[model samples]
Target: MNKILRSFTLFTALSAASVGVHAGNYWTASAQDGWIDGYVEATLLLSGNLDASGIDTDVDDGTVTLRGKVETDIDKALAQELALGVDGVIGVENMLTVFSPGDNDDAAKQRKLTDEKVATVVKTRLMVAPNVTSADIDVNSTKGVVVLQGKVKNDAEKQRATEIATKASDVEKVVNKLSVSE
Candidate 1:
């Protein structure tokens, strides 16, 4: 009875070891190269054919995860298709969401109008500033955030431009990327 019990225990251990080996081999086979490679390839593939501005991608092992909002259902499906086409991508987790048309349209339009107003106000302020040169400055506003880009003669001019932008109505933030010329 002891001999039979010993044999049964050994057989059970062997079976468990074989199962582990098979599982390891299966995982290795599925993950052909690396997750990074899969991510890059999928990104390039999607970017080539799509606008790709709002789309984001993540890869784990052989599975690809796509996230972000697309304009339409067609765009969402296209993004998934592009991701799946990549080599070594065994599965695709398509988590892309479509942009809501009715609600988003009104909000986007309002935001754009607000941004335009902010930019115009900032521009007018810069023009009125005695020491600042408004000709070379480029003003762009998005969602109350103003981006001032161009060249300035000195640090004072950069500071003045930022101040002007920050004072505009509804201006939430100001990004001054103006280069001061020596």
Candidate 2:
């Protein structure tokens, strides 16, 4: 009885600790995540052996994205339902795809190239954007292609800036480093 009680206490303590670590707006871009602690816990439980241990869910904004590996379709469904039930998750975009147990490098490489292409396209699009002045938009590139940094009027403008910067081009990815106020 003592051993069981001790184990339960430990589990509770660890769960609380995980939530404490992810209580900031630094994880994602939406505003709803700040109030959804249970969502984070649900995701952690459903991750099974999938390794998203570092995946932060403390995004002060509402945007919550959950990524991990699941062996069975049932597990996937449960995780999705739990994620959707979370307070701040307006949408749950499944990027998990499927992961075969064996070694796979093709998908990884493709992701790199796609990210680069997105960056390139986003850069080109932003350069010619209607209200955007490219001179102020600092763009950076890695294997992923583009990362935008600067300030914009609002989220709409920021999104537009990202869109113009990441249009269908050679770019593989576009990182919106842009900031917004009102």
RMSD of each: 16.8, 15.3
**Residue 120 lDDT, candidate 1, scale 0-100:** 56
Candidate 1, residues 1-182: lDDT per residue as tens digits?
99999999999999999999999987776565455445434343424334567776776776778788777655565566555544456788888788743343566555654555456556655765789988899899887789999999999999999987886667899999999988
* Location of the lowest summed lDDT over 10 successive residues in candidate 2: 47-56
Clashes of each: 0, 29
Tens-digit lDDT track of model 2 for 47-156? 43333443334433444455656554333443444455444566665544344444334665445434433443344445546777555666665664677898776777
Q: Which one wins on TM-score?
A: 1
Compared with the true structure, all predictions reach lDDT values of 0.70, 0.54
* Lowest lDDT block of 10, candidate 1: 40-49
Q: Give the TM-score of candidate 2.
A: 0.31
**Candidate 2: deviation at residue 103, Å?**
33
